[model samples]
Target: MMENHKIAEEVIDAVGGRENIQSVAHCATRLRIMVNDKEKINQEHVEQINKVKGAFFNSGQYQIIFGTGTVNRIYEEIANLGLATMTASDQKKEAVKSGSKIQRAVRTFGDVFVPIIPVLVATGLFMGLRGLVMQDQVLALFGMKTDDVSKNFILFTQVLTDTAFIFLPALVAWSTFRVFGGTPIIGLILGLMLVSPSLPNVWSVAGGDVKPLHFFGFIPVVGYQASVLPAFIAGIIGAKLERAIRKRIPESLDLILTPFLTLLSMIILSLLVIGPAFHTVEKGILTAATTVLSLPFGIAGIILGGLNQVIVVTGVHHIFNMLEIQLLAQYHSNPYNAIVTCAGAAQGGATLAVALKTKSKKLKALSFPSALSAFLGITEPALFGVNLRYGKPFIMALIGGACGGFVASLLKLKATGMALTVIPGTLLYLNGQVLLYILVNLIAIAVAFVLTWMFGYSDKIKEEVEK
Candidate 1:
């Protein structure tokens, strides 16, 4: 482990040190980095690192793909170096200053969350599958569900998926702390505080009315259960505090004292500042969503449908997940989530259209499964393989998705329960009018088909026009 840590440090230095990084996030096997300047990033040098599998860029981020088990350690080393700064280049700086309030909020969310998509998808899939298995009686009898499945399937997958959310903070804290260069142990403590059952609710007040909570009579912040932003902000602050304390503490006691001070300061700040601030931000997101969905159905559908593709491209789709799940838990049906489902259905149809129209055997073969997988709510395969490659299919999908989204919103289509997959998941919204949902899905697919057929698949266009 020590030797690996040394190599990780060297890799950071070779990639122009921490100063070059604006933000860092990882996917299934790739470290997605947004740098201060793309020119400053030495891609060749990054690829040369011993454990690095490869490096590439897409959607405005530089990605370093790593073999299994290597990225976590390297990410830790990068964070330890204190290079993750939020500052942007002159162009981005001006955009930040000049952009409208909504634009700024969207950009901020993107900056913080885009890099962490792989983790979200993996864990979501895990959770979804676990729900599927546990809900099945056959699997329930086994350890997979109840540790007694008569079937011979192994139950380990059940344990891993079912318990992911319970320990999710530890995962987020570890990742956020690695991004900020803090001790994982300290992050674990802060994460524990957010999820700890012993913590008192802020809503309780002396006169039987709700009131805000305070931390040690100093900072005022709210509880953070199943939250993302607060813990991240706290982790960064904690890392910085640890570094400052480390510089002043005596060498013999530095190890113990540094963490002690850092943890206390971070907890105070989190409760008082970070947590409440993010709560406000969360409210803002909710307000915006409510306002938009209140508009006429057609306009709402068009905007959401059109933007759904853009949202996924930028990797901010998970923000919708928080709203969908949380609001559904509260309200039993969410208009926003229903629109998102419509958008997914649109993508599925567009991809399927491209698959059918393409003349190239290779393209057709690849797109078919991609479309099917996307219909099942796994989009990356289709997004990267078919729609993106062909370009026009994606454009068609966006337009159709927006149209579908608007219609769904207009109709006030709401999901009664969460879905495990986007397509089959749309069934969650079915309320006796299963035919209406099916019709809506079919309409989106038909629009996508017409658009793709008119535009022509990339491969077919090249072949016919060139001929």
Candidate 2:
């Protein structure tokens, strides 16, 4: 108790004391502090404090990483000190206030997309499993050919893999509306209208199996199955329109009239204007992404793999969520996942190397679990808690990531999913690509471990550890 209290007090002093802190919050692994003046805080002093692994300013908050179990105790001590505190969600809102327009926009994208990732991750796993079971070699071992599989069984697998994507617009719209402060149920209904069974299916229309319905002899209408940008934009516009309508309507009629007017106007606008216009824009973006992913000699993989962790430090990596979704929607696979996993794997390897080499028992204890966490596809702990704390390890990890990415691209590796990476990410590669996946990740880990072991730790790190 005495140690935790002392640590909390020192943190407060290092970050320029109670008056500088506008608000404070803690997540699972970091104490997030929003301050009145950034220049007043001493970052080096904060990092030197006991139990403080590292500190960085990102997305309008000064964050101090202190590993998992330790953070909660320190947070309790801080709360007991009678300083102003808020929930992590509220702190994120506060942090938004301090960010630039572009930063805020990127953060908003993260906010909207993060909630929907689990469903996609689950669906991707199902797809990979189904792909494995349905392979010709696997089926032959079971004494059955592809034709021997039941149509009913095939339909069941499709249900597992296809439901989320079939209703992707609804999911995106629902999430967007919630983020933008509008009624989520109304947004959900609006999304359903875009992909309504009454309209021709998007794939069928595209494949020429069916003609699009011609409205007014020029505009053709089709369902928006697995679409993204149109629904996202529509949600933003719909939410604002709903708010506007609510204000103009009388209090007595608010319940009945607000939703009716909002939906009616949004339906027309989305179908005619938002859907057609934004979808073209979405296609252009996807084409550009594909072009980059196909760049000669694995250039795209090398650049993204090396700089992805750097982007994470800046706190705007969530924009990749949109691209990953777009790739799955169009191509039924995400190449980005395989490439980015190298970045996470490299960070884990570097942290593990530190844990093995460090003389400080406290540092080793914190680093081992953090490294394990990174291998399981969560990099924040190992990253901010260990590698970045020592500086040189992070650079070594980046070089390792670039090497792994080059191999992934050279082998034309891709994943069945997004969101999950590194170890749990193996689920996405189970369809005959497991060996290749393991090889790529092993290379990443080995390169990072060797480089970090050789040059990342030095007398400077030892001095910091002693302090």
Candidate 3:
């Protein structure tokens, strides 16, 4: 307790003292603090502080990296010291408002989806494992035909792998509601109603097992499963509408009437209008993605693979998960993940080369872990902390990723899931193309490493060390 307070005091001092802070928040890995003035911050002193992994200013906040658990303790101490604390969602809203329209839209996409990533990660792993177990070779080894696996086992794996996506609307709606200031539980309930058993399952409608219900013998509506855009739109409407309704309703009836009216209106509007309309938009996005990916000679892959990390630097890459998940849900495969994995490997590769060639101990210390983290599908540390700081390395990594993505697309490589990549990403390719996956990774790493070593680390390396 005392140590946390001491660290908090040091951090506060480093950032030009408590008086300079306007608001503060913490997420899984960083202390996100908004200050009244950036000039007052002693950047060098903050970097030198103990228990600080790294620090950088982005989205109008000076975010100090603290790995994981330590951040919460330090944040608690700072709050106890009387600084106003913001929720993670509120912090995202603050950050999103600082950007240009396109950047703000991207950040908004990230804010809506970031909270749900853990569930997606778990679903991805489960899908990978299920694929591994169901392979023909695995079945043969067990002295069974494709049909021989126990029905019970298959059903159990479905529960693990499909539950999240099957009810994905609920999850997305719940998170979106929280981020947008609606009652999250109400958001969840509204989302559930969209996929209620009373409505035909979306898959059943698509597969011809059941028909979409018609209203007044004309318009048709159905349940939403593995759908994102609709759930997202519904959440925003539901949240804003609830707030507006509450403002006019009297206090005596507020508690009961507010929720009742909010859900009732949202339910009818979503089923009769929002779901069908947004579902079409989602399908168009899915089709476009598929068409572009299937373009001759992997041109789209090369271009996207190269630019994806660049997009990450702008904090917009989180939007790609939507594409990956949509592909997986509709097509039972995700070539996008395969291409992006190569891109991720290239980031690590370039960072590793910089680490190897750098003369500065500070650069080396920061680059190594950042490189490894990139390989494991987390790149902020590498992108923000090391690669972007050196212009050439980032460009070199981009070129390398293009080459890797080209190879992946040409080979028609696919992953069983989304989210996991590189080392842990191996689970995604366990359907017997392990060698192909490894080859793609190596190609990316090798290209990025050679390019970076040859030209990425600049003459400024020694100058940084001297400072």
Candidate 4:
């Protein structure tokens, strides 16, 4: 506790003291501070603070990297020191009203989907496992026929995988509402309404098995399954509308009227306007992405592979969910997975290089787990915690990803599905392509390690950050 407080105090002082701070917040890896005067910040001093990995000014705020868990303790001490603690929702509300259009959109995408990543990760693992168990070759290798599989076991895996996509809108709406300052339960209920079983199943509509319901003889509405955009749009409107209604109603009547009125109004708007419009826009985006990703010579693969992690850093990588789903549905394979995996794997490579090159104990301690996490298919630990913080490692990783992606394109590599890469990616690719996947990942890691060691990573810089 004393150490945390001391670090917090130093960080506060280094960023121009508490008075220089307009507001303070922290995410999983960094202390995000909005200051009244950027000029008051002693940049070098802050970078020199013990346990401060790296610092940079971006998008009107200063972000000081402290890796995971540490930032929370430091942030708490800042709060104890009388600095106001802003909730994630409060930050979202502020960002929307004040930030640029693109910034607001990216923040919203992040806010809506980040709350649901855990379930998605679990589902990805389940998919990999299920695919492994269901393969005829694997079943035969186990001295069993595909027909001998246990129905109950298949059901269990299917349930885990199906639940997330089947009711995705609820998660999106609930998160969106929470971020947008509305009642989360209300938002979730509203999202549930968008995918209610009373409406025709989206697949049936798509396959021409059923027609979308015609509302008032004109508007066409269907169930939103495996969709993200509709609930996000509806959540914003519902949150804003609920807040507006709460302000005008009597305090005693607020509880009774607000939830009912908010759900009713949002449901009508979503079914008639937001759901249809956003769904159309989502389709257009998926179509365009498909065209680009299918280009000859793997140009799309190389570009996406090289720069995909850069997109992940912006918190808007959730936008690709629809594209991946479409690719798998249309082609039975997703090249996007192969490409993004390279980007994800390269971070581990770069971070490993940093760890190997760094002499500082603290730097080595932080770099190892960040690199390991990236190799296991999560890169934020390495990206924000190490590579992005150091600057050069991140760029080197991008180059490695591009090179790996170009190779994947040339090899015509694809994934059985989206999600899972690096270490975890091996399990899904074990269907006779394990050797190729291993080779590709090794190439990416080697490229990133070589480049970062040669030019990006420096032991001197690590010493300065820890000085």
Which candidate should be chosen as best, given TM-score against the real structure? 2
* lDDT, candidate 4, 256-294, per-residue tens: 999989989999999999998998987887788878877
TM-score for each candidate, following the candidate numbering: 0.59, 0.93, 0.88, 0.81
| lDDT tens per residue, model 3, 159-262 | 99888888889988998898788999999999899889999898999899899999978778899988988899999999999999999999999999999999
lDDT of 2 by residue, 86-122 (tens): 9999999878876789999999999998999999999
Model 1 TM-score? 0.59
Candidate 1 lDDT tens digits, 249-331: 99999888888888788777777778778756866776776777788637877887778867777655655655654343234
Q: For every model in order, what is the number of clashing pairs? A: 17, 0, 0, 0
Q: What residue runs in model 3 are displaced by over 4 Å at the alpha carbon?
A: 1-18, 23-25, 42-54, 66-97, 100-104, 458-467
Query: For model 3, what is the error of residue 156's alpha carbon versus the real structure, in angstroms, after optimal superposition?
Result: 2.0
**lDDT: the better of candidates 2 and 3:** 2
Q: What is the lDDT of candidate 3?
A: 0.85
Q: Quick one: best lDDT, which candidate?
A: 2
lDDT of 1: 0.62
Superposing every Cα of model 1 onto the true structure, what RMSD results? Answer: 10.8
RMSD of each: 10.8, 2.3, 3.2, 4.2
Please list the C-alpha lDDT of all candidates, in the order they appear: 0.62, 0.89, 0.85, 0.80
Estimate the overall C-alpha local distance difference test score of candidate 4. 0.80
